[model samples]
Structures are given as C-alpha cells and as structure tokens.
Target: MKRVYAKEDVCIGCRLCEIACVVEHSESKNAIRTYKTEVPRPVARNVVEERGPLTFSVNCRHCDEPLCVAVCIAGAMVKDEESGVVRHNEEKCVGCWSCVMICPYGVIKMKPAAKKVSKCDLCNGRTMPACVQACPNRAIVYEER
Candidate 1:
C-alpha cells in the first residue's frame, strides 16, 4: 500500500499541503469560496512542525497495530486489512477523546464545533492524498515501501 511520507530535508515549511488538504476536504471544494465564505470552516489534517532549522509535516501513520482503533469507545475507528487504512465513523463517534489521547503521534484533533475527532484517512483511499499532491517542494510523497 502507498502511504504519505515526508522528507524533512527538503521541507521549506510553506504549508501548502495543509492548505490543499483543507480545501480538498472542504464542503465547497473551492479555495476562494472556502476562505471567503468560510463554508464549513476549513480544517487541516496534516500540520507542519518546525524545529530550529528543520520542518516536517505530520499526519496519521495508519499503524499496523492502531491504538486509536482500540481505544475508540464508540467503535468509531476501524482499520481496514485490505488497504491498511484506518477509517473513522463520524455517525458513531461520540466525541470521546480516547483515540486522541492514545495516538502517540498526536495527529488526531478534536472538532470542537462538531464534537468529533478528526485525522487523516489518506483522503479516503484516493489515488493520492491532497497533501501529497499539493506539496510545492515535493517534501511529501505517497509511496509503497
């Protein structure tokens, strides 16, 4: 399976990936409309973390042994064996922070308005995640290893 990977050596901290992700997941799917209209209030899945001289974008790893899936009290998170992708069920979610607390990478975030937990689902099995596609410097990539 292909997964998103970051090459911190090349990262320039532009954060275009974050912007693209918000737009791609936005309700209107238009960059101008999403920001101008604030439709659905754009949220980013991946975030760039900066060090003194280095930066890297981070998101869900979709681990082989997913702690988020195991800790989800409402049975909202599940791992797919075929795709090695972990998906969250918004309808079943109860806004419990169990998954968020258990995720070692701290990728999961609480959607306070909707009272839901949100993370990267690799763009729900798209050919490539929006973040990877929108990387201006190719610091992020989707690859099989």
Candidate 2:
C-alpha cells in the first residue's frame, strides 16, 4: 500500500502541507474560507515538526499492526485490510483517547471541542494526498516501498 513519507533532508518546514490538508478536509475547500470562516477550525491531519535546524512532517504511518486499532474501546479506529489505511470514525468515537495514547507515532491528535481524535487518512478519495502535492520542496512523497 502506498504511504506518505517525508524526506527530512530537503524539508524546509514551510508548513504549506498543513494548510493544504485543512483545505482538503474542510467543508468549503477554500484556503481563505477554511482558515477565516470555519467554525471549530478544521485540523490538519499532518503536522510539521521542527527542532533546532532540523524539520520534518509527521503523520500516520498506517502500520501493519497498529496499536491504535487495538486500544480503541469504541471500535472507531480501524485498519482497512485492502488499502492498509488506518481510519478513525468520528461517529463511533467515544473520545476516550485510547487510540491517542496507544499510537506509537504520536500522530493522533485530540479534538477537544468535537471530543474526537484526528489523524492522517491519506486524503481519502484523492489520487495523491494534499500534503504531498503541496510540498514545494518535494520533501514529502506518496509511494510504496
């Protein structure tokens, strides 16, 4: 299965990836509208991390054996056998934070206002994820190893 990977060496940490992700997942799908008018604020599934001079983006790894799936008490976290994508169902989520605590990558994020967790879903229904496409440096790539 194809996954998103970040090449830290070339990452400039511009964080356009995060904005693109918000737009892709937003109701309006417009950068200005999403950032300006959206209520509750749409969260980016992928995040850019920086320490000193080193920077890179982080998102779900969609591991073959994801601990988040195992620890989800409400069964909201599921790994698609066919695509190998781990998805979080907001409707079924109880906001217990089990998946948040168990994710080894620490990519799962808490949405306090919505009482749900958010993580990378590989931009579902897109041929390429928003993060990968928005990466000007080509630091982030979507491909299978």
Candidate 3:
C-alpha cells in the first residue's frame, strides 16, 4: 500500500494540510460553512509539528507491528490485510484509549464527545489524502515502496 510521507526540508508550516484535513472530513465538506456552523469545529487527524526551524506533519504510520491494534479492547483498531492501513472502526470503538497509550508515534487521539478514537484512514474516499493534495509546497506525498 502507498503511504503519505513528508519532506521536512520543504515544509513551510503553513498548516494547509491541517485545514484541508478538517474540511475533507467535515460533514458537508465545505471549508467556510464547516467552520462557521460547526460547533467547536473539527479536529484534524493529521497534525503539524513545528520547532525552531523545522516543521513536519504527522499521522498514523500504519506500522507493520502496530501495538495500538494489539491493545484495543473494543477491537476497533485493525490493520487491513489487503491495504495495510491501520483503520479505526468508530462504531466498534469503546473509547477505551488503549490504542492511545500503545501507539509509539503518539498519533492516535480521542474524540471524547463522540466516544471514539480518531486517526488517519488514508482518506479512502479519494486517491490521495486531503492533506497531501492541499500542501502547496509539495512537502507531502503519497508513495509506495
């Protein structure tokens, strides 16, 4: 399976990817309306990290040996055998936070109000993730190795 990777050297930390992520997953998929009408707004699955002179976006790596899946009590987290994407089944999630504790990348997050966990699913709706498409500087790309 192809995955999203970052070229930190070109990342401008503009957060376009973050914005695009929120909009992509937004209820209506509209940037302006989603912000104005949605209460508290949507939290992005992918996060941008910035240091003194460094910037990079991070999300679920869908690791070969994901500890998150092993500890998920609700069995909501699973790596798709065909795609190798670590998918979180929101309906099956028990909000146990077990995956949150076990993820070495610190990427998994809780949607407390929704009583579910959230992580990157690689945007199955499209060929590429919203973040990758939205990155103006091409700091991010989807590649298979």
Superposed model 3: Cα runs more than 4 Å off = none
The best candidate by lDDT is 2
lDDT of 2: 0.93
lDDT of each: 0.88, 0.93, 0.88
Which residue pairs show collisions in model 3? none
CA lDDT, candidate 1, residue 29 = 82
Q: TM-scores across all candidates? A: 0.95, 0.98, 0.95
- Superposed model 2: Cα runs more than 4 Å off: none
The runs of at least 3 residues in candidate 1 whose Cα sits more than 4 Å from the true structure, single-residue gaps closed, are none
**Worst lDDT 10-window in candidate 1:** 38-47
Better of 1 and 2 by lDDT: 2
RMSD of 1: 1.1
- The best candidate by TM-score is 2
Worst 10 residues of 2 by lDDT: 97-106
Model 1: per-residue Cα lDDT over 1-145, one tens digit each: 7788999999999999989888888888888898888845767987789988799999999999999999888989999999899998889999988998999988888888898988898997478889998998899999998
Query: Clashes in each model (backbone N, CA, C under 3 Å)?
Result: 0, 0, 0
